[model samples]
Target: MATAWFPLWLTLKVALLATLGSGVVGILLALLIARSRLWLRDGLDGVIMLPMVLPPTVLGYYLIVVVGRNGMLGRWLYERFGVSLIFTWQGAVLAASIVSLPLIYKAARAAFEEVDPSLENAARLLGSGEAAVFLRVTLPLALRGIGAGLMLSFARAMGEFGATLMIAGNLPGRTQTLSIAIYDAVQAGDDHRAGLLSLLMSAVCITLLFLSGRLLRARHRA
Candidate 1:
């Protein structure tokens, strides 16, 4: 029974951590892309959004090439810090983060852009620094929309499959997340396990979707 529940626990942990890390980075990137006058804004947004449209297998392959033990960052980490991301739960978190990033990015960017620039300029005229202006005017105004995106990111991470499978290798009790567990159970003809896992995933995802929608509607009303 404990074994039956392990994947769920692992999936929750991976999704939570992934969402936290990715949501912050995504929101920050969205801010940059939405407000910066830099020429690279469009290019950065395109690269960030690619994960949303690319085949999961293609993304997985890219992850492998960039993070595998022989890969650049992987090699540096292993040699410098004796750390390896391969086949670990941390690797799964990284995969989930990458796959789910676009959700948060899009949501955050839209939210930030919707905030009236006049309000920010008003703060600036009142002697607020850039950071102060963002914190007091832009961020508070955009919080609800960013929250919607974060919830979506959590759901997407909880259901991550191909990239996680590639980087984390479906190691039960170690890195096998709920989605991978369901796949493994189905492949092994364990319908009962698969059914339970599916139910769990469905319930959580539905809840997140519902909450995200409410937040978006509320944001618009504001």
Candidate 2:
């Protein structure tokens, strides 16, 4: 039924956008962290990695505190721009991005760290600017690990439920993503729908993870 299939499509859309948002942010953060020599680098890395260990509900609570209508950032946005994230698809993307960030962050950081510093130095010696060196030398070398991380992050985003539920209420045809849809189906005693949705999501996530593993193994081989 079209009604039953909405969640799967919505989830794929959200997960793809979330992966893009998180991938760019994660790579930027990883570059910053990997290149920094400050003593606070490790502490910053720990902070970025927090979502990996924190409960999804806890992450949802933090997001609400920061993005709720009355919260500082949320209030400012509402007042200045009339923007609101709560109970919207964009909110779901934000939740997924936060929940999935750690996967890409860890992978990107490790990739950046593993890149040869001497290669970057040589680029600099050849009159390449910092940005040029990153694009021409650092990024190419780190692409494999970053790619693996991005695929993993995509899978994680596709499965994000708790945080997304809290921020973006399950509105059929609006924000009821695949994971939330499964929960809704189970709660409504629709075992058939629930099972079908579960299988679909599982298949998609498994494909993503398989590709990620292959990328990682290829990286190791290379």
Q: Tell me, what's the RMSD of every candidate?
A: 2.0, 2.2
Candidate 2 lDDT tens digits, 176-219: 99999989999999999899888888887787778778877977
Supply every candidate's count of residue pairs whose N, Cα or C atoms clash at under 3 angstroms. 0, 0
Runs of candidate 2 exceeding 4 Å displacement? 210-222
Per-residue CA lDDT of candidate 1, range 88-148, in tens? Answer: 9999999999999999999999999999989999999999999899889999999988888
What's the TM-score of every candidate structure?
0.92, 0.91
Model 1 lDDT, residue 55, Cα: 86
Best by TM-score: 1
Error of 2 at 27 (Å): 0.6
Question: What value does the lDDT take at residue 172 in candidate 2?
Answer: 89
